[model samples]
Target: MVVGYWRLAGITSGLACAAGALQAQLLVRAALGARHTSTLVHDSIITPFVLRPALAPALAVTAATPLDERWTAQVTLDFSTSTLERHDADGTTTGLGRVSTLAFTVGLRRPLGAGFAAGAGVGGLKYLPAGETGIFRSGAGGVLGLAGAVVSYAPPRVGGRWQLGIEARYDVHRFITPALRSEGFTSARTVHRIALALRAGRGGAAGAAGAAGAAP
Candidate 1:
């Protein structure tokens, strides 16, 4: 009796491992297949879903004017492009499509006493999709107003007129597409984005001379 039970246990464990491997393969296939066809699974309703952007590189240009010793007025133009991913209730994700993002922001920055500065920005965010498929079936969503905050650090004791810096930014906006609304989405989802980037240019500090000014 004991020998027979041991054999049954070994078979069960082996079957479990095989099932896990098969499930992983199917998951991968589903993600790849989503790019080719829309009929991944037909249900009563497409209902609501989540779409997210992958980590992307951002390019930016800025203009600034000193307001006072501690404050500076700044305007920035930024752009990023990456793939949009769809998140489902089953915790599985697929690539919906590629999207390019553009934004124009105006903000004010003030130093934090140790080469760090904090700023708040208000702007408009626009989405440009490569194709009008997936959630962008009707068209790319219109531009939405957004607000963001940034923190930057620059070593004041280095560099010439150009002061190199690092910045971290965070923003939030509501997202909803025409196709998503038509498919039964009632409310827009709040989307949050965060980026960390290296910045080179004016330190944007007021009344601070860089290393070049002090060179004898």
Candidate 2:
């Protein structure tokens, strides 16, 4: 069952990566004659209050570097809660509890110009604090899982020190227990997320001009 889940996740990631590559190629073909530099770099963090089911805070950071005027490679780190207490109808708390998780991602991006961009990426992560109560038990059954994401970005504006973007990612996490254990065991935890982000930096004539001559 674990193997099957892993294979499914791998297929999903592969499809996402292929889509991103195709988009990049299309962008390059569209602007074949333009004189444009192939580099625009920026970083941002997404904070989602509703996304966090528990009292703990959550944040996602992305480091993006353009491969060309319309293509970019991005690395992302996401830290958030995986599970929260199930409250009763009367707002009473249950004793049963679950943990949260953090993930790392790498992907590609393609710009549609006019301050709009989109792309895809594939990544995998090993659940932290793994143990008796962790996502996976200690054994050969435990292993890293795969994930994929599609994202969009808006270019920074002149006289503005901030930028905005959005993303939707699919996460697949597998949980397993040895034959000896019976209480906790599962195939995978799959979910989708929609995120909004903001980024801040020094924005002036120099930065704006640089962005224009380069990738934006």
Candidate 3:
């Protein structure tokens, strides 16, 4: 009985210490609109088409913890739903039904003064296809790895613990699949995306009043 009591006490203290060490600030955001450039999927043989995802109307959530006086560590999660579009040589386009994209990234952010901040990070992107068709006949490239970066602007706190801001983000990744490889394509195409959104978060006044970007 004494050993059991000691074990329970150890567990409780461990939980308390973890909770005290990892104080995180949360931010919720929604994309005003988004866009992706057309990239060549396959070239020089068979039916060739360029691929692009109609990006818009997405949402994101971010959690951040201050690492120092000038830097903060953050993780962001975002997702979008759209049609996977294919463009032919003749410039005609076809929609490949409903597709969903989910992404997660870890990054560091620092204030650039005057309500501006810069951040960069790396992440993974997964494509969920509605059906087995088009280039996704085998699967949407198996969770392509990606690199992402962001810039944001947050005004002075509006007399509260939560704050509002705007952010611009960009991501890049290589696109390929077993289906593409089987179709005589040997190389992966580079895909790029850009987005803008409005965000509201718990630590908006981090850097504005010489708070040094620390979460309160």
**Considering every candidate listed, which one attains the maximal lDDT?**
3
Candidate 1 whole-model C-alpha lDDT, 0 to 1: 0.63
**TM-score pick, better of 1 and 2:** 1
Residue 100 of model 2, lDDT score: 45
Across 105-210, the per-residue lDDT of candidate 2 in tens digits comes to 7877665566555556666554343234421344424444656554444455542433433334444544333522443333433434333334322221333224
Cα TM-score of candidate 3: 0.79
Evaluated against the true structure, the overall lDDT of model 3 is: 0.71
When sorted by lDDT, best at the front, the candidate numbers are 3, 1, 2
- lDDT (Cα, tens digit) per residue for candidate 3, span 99-203: 777899998888888778888999898878898876789887777888988888877664255556778888888888778889887888888877787766663
lDDT of each: 0.63, 0.43, 0.71
Q: List the candidate numbers ranked by TM-score, top first.
A: 3, 1, 2
Off by over 4 Å in 2: 1-56, 86-95, 129-143, 155-159, 166-168, 175-186, 199-216
Against the correct fold, how does model 2 do in TM-score? 0.50
Residue pairs whose backbone atoms clash in candidate 1:
none
